[model samples]
Target: MGRVSPPVLPAACEVLVVGAGPAGSACARTLAAAGHDVLLVDQHVFPRDKVCGDGLIPDAHAALRVLGVHDEVMDRALRAAHVRCVAPRGGHVDVPGTLAVLPRRDLDDIVCRAARAAGARFAAPWRFVAPLLDGERVVGARLRGDGIEHEVRARWVVLATGAAAPPLVAAGVCERRAPSSVALRGYLHHPELAATLRELQIVWHPRLSGGYGWIFPGPGGTFNVGVGLTASHASEEGGRASMREVNLRRMLDTFAAVHAPAAGLLARGELRGDWKGAPLRCSLGGARWSRPGLLVTGEAAGSTYAFTGEGIGKALETGLLTAAALAEGGDDAAVRARHEAALAGLKPRFELYEKAAHVNRLPWLADLVVWRARRSPRILRRMSAVLEERQNPGRLLSWRGMTKLMFE
Candidate 1:
């Protein structure tokens, strides 16, 4: 990982972005392109690993387009994704979509490069220690890098600090709702699964309880496989039972039985190691994302898809929207009003998906849904479209093709 040396901060700038992930980079790129002097800072260096499935849906690509980096990223994408949904009863359904797989390290680097090219100054390995306040208003942030601390001021600040919104919430610039679930994931090498790398497989086992396991392929025959469970269920079951180990074992067992013996593949590829788990926060409920000069976006703003555990896409979308709102040059109240209006239009459908995930309380519901989806091509297509946000029917249960799922 290469680090960019910190540049001397001017007295103040138009915008200051903390935590340069997808959201920060996207916001910086958009704002800078619109001729705003923007400073983007991150705690890590370039090409740093961010634990994610690394799956890019069509909507994500659309977000990249809004940031003007879609073509560049697509040129480096590894594969077009084919989604496979597996049930506890062993039923499965494969639905094709406009999805792609790319490592997060690479993806973030690409986005950061675009932002830099768009004239946003970047400082990596710079920790955002605290927000610099001018009385009751947020003026900028205090950053520490290379063992020295400095104050960088800006007219407006955008917080993209991800899951740990950090001191911002404590500073009263942001707030958080309770997270519904937690996710565990890690990377491994599974050559036998390479051919199927183009296909992103999600296994919904009843034993997992409220969450599913997934296997996503990355560059050079590496795979990311992990499981997620509702926090409440995980707590009730026990804290130290090793969800990652159990899920990895289950995945390897399934893979070996189904595809191991095909042309000496098992000998070539075997279960590599254990999967690591990370916490996942659900950004479903309506919440205020901004305060005064400080605006929040991405995971910090609760923009993740509760059901799919997809946050990068929504994060990017919020980044673009935030940039647009800032570009209009409004006061805090005006920018906040525009931001809330934009989110209001999208929150209902997201809430519906969150509700659907919670509603699958029955042990057999996931299996039944998968079985019916496999039997009906329309169901599979609709489900894929809905999950990818290519189509929004508003009511998840009211879709005629999903009636079997609703009844089950």
Candidate 2:
């Protein structure tokens, strides 16, 4: 029963967005800007900590501009023009592009505020309990907050709850999938590293296979350091084994000690807090986009880039794309089909990234690419395009592009 006890209020809106992160905010702000009434809800308030590397590449910059918060974020976060990638053989290449390091606490608040500023009603501490259904179609969501339970009815429910797999799981659009990749991130105060930090750095570990570590310069004198291992790499030591079997905690500690760049920085600073880890469900562009009236966006829909484990930009992009579809003002089915068709545009790039995720396992290939790029300005620029997401992930798969990348 979609019941709300007495004294619990009921509200109706055109659209109800489940999470206030980048994807939800992007969708709500766009919808509200287009003259639709939107109510955005979240389980937590703004300015709270989240486990992320806190690095924003060029694609993220584009999303912020669409949200009208690009200047706000850029004004606060430190900037860089290049990313330093170190291969397992210790060779390095500097890929030119704009990047920044702003903590998730700050970034999420900026986006959420943008949504509110756009006239979307904001509600926090309201946990989405389940989809309020009319037969088979979702009409809204049952929520719990303030020691009371209620339902917020809307024409459509947007699931931007992210990696938690919340509303989707409850509504039976999906299940709690396992760890396709594992990541742990923490902050550190390193004034020395901060003073000289000009670029975000990534390092490929020779023995970790498909895993990489990163050091991003955060606001103030802080640095964000972390490691990630894709499922392919995780299953290597033991079939279908978890993070424990891979000794993820130990691996991060070892990388921080021996990975030259990371070691130097950690040695010069003290840890800020305990490392936070999370499992990810990557690009599910292959899965169902919508069932009835609910649509999943962001990491919930698998918009993450498997190769680099990057998802923020894709999340925001997909959110805006979804907003466009919903704002078309058609019936639910038409809106869903439109959104599904639009998402197909992301599949080619995702398939290309799937191939790159496999290539990440080979140390020699990474070494060759980095070494060649270091020697070839054209190749270096092209490689940078890959990170900036300006170039398709498939570009490197082309014979012509590969020949230039190898021989130029």
Candidate 3:
């Protein structure tokens, strides 16, 4: 990882982007390419690890194209992916997607560099202390780094700070709320696991309620494995049991016991300090994403995919849309309307997926549906399209084709 000293004194730029993650970098790069003076800042340094499955779906590629970083991103991604779905009966379904795998450390570094190359100034290891307000309007932000504080002034401010929207939300620049689910993930270096690099496995267990466990391979012998559960369900009477420390441990043990009993791949890999954990916040509702001179993108605005817990693609897309909207130069009311419109267009699908994830509540019925779909290629295709966000699941379910599925 590489760190840069923070700037001192008040700074001025046409745009100030807080958080240098995918969303922030994408916004900065797009605006800078338009010849706008842009500044991007993050609390962490380059090459820092972010907890993720490290898998990039086709939609993610689409987002990269919009950001104009597709070529560079393609150069860094693992070209193909093999997906395996483990059913409750221990049966596995192997599906394939035009997926790519890359570590966040490397990906974020590439994106930030690209943003800089596009003429965006960067301030890293800089803490966003608060938003500098112009009385009901955000003028800029007061940042601190390397024991020095500086005020950055900009005509427009973008919040791409991921799940924690930071001082902007906390300072009342935007309304923020907690996610519906929290995730815990870790990395490991296991040659045996690496041998399965081409195959990313998703284990659907009844124990996880609405969520599933995943194992995704990265470059070298590295792999990421994690589990997530709905916060609302996990906070109930027995909800606390689903926390990573408890349920995750049991799930991992069960997986290893059933799949790799003789070799103990997970136990051996843990001895090398190849594991870590972090939280994944679900998209929450009621976050004030835009205001006069201020706008929020990515996880900060709860734009993540509900079922798969995927945020990078949504974040990138949100960033691009936000930059385009801001380019139109609107008043507070106009910007807020545009922001809300963008979110409204996407929120329904995410909410639908979230609802579908709970189908596990009826295990036998859900399994039967999966089983039937597996046998019918047409049904599987439709289901897959729905999952990929290509079609609305609600409409798909309401279709005549699905009606036949119910009878048959």
The residue-level lDDT of candidate 2 at 381 comes to 76
Task: Provide the overall lDDT of each model, using Cα atoms, as 2-decimal numbers.
Answer: 0.70, 0.79, 0.69
Encode model 2's per-residue lDDT on 1-408: one tens digit a residue: 333333333488889998888899999999998889999988886667878777898789999998899999988998888888888878888888878889989998999898888899887778888998999999999988867788888899998887764556786776434556778887888887788876888887666676788888888888898888875324334343334356667767777765776777667777888778876667654235787889888878888888888888888999999999998878877999888888888878877787777555765667777877777777777787898776775566444545756665
Deviating ranges (above 4 Å) for candidate 2 = 1-10, 232-244, 285-287, 397-408
Q: What does candidate 3's lDDT look like per residue over 47-95, in tens digits?
A: 6878777788767888887767778877877666446666666666555
Per lDDT, the best of the predicted structures is 2
lDDT of 1 by residue, 159-188 (tens): 887766454555465443334456666666
How much is 377 displaced in model 2, in angstroms? 1.3
lDDT for residue 227 in candidate 2, whole number 0-100 = 86
TM-score of every model versus the real structure = 0.85, 0.91, 0.87
Candidate 1: residue 105 lDDT (0-100): 83
* Model 3 pairs whose backbones collide: 234-239
TM-score of 1: 0.85
Task: Indicate whether candidate 1 or candidate 2 has the larger TM-score.
Answer: 2
Q: Answer with 2 or 3, whichever has the higher lDDT.
A: 2
Q: Model 2, residue 314: what's the lDDT?
A: 85
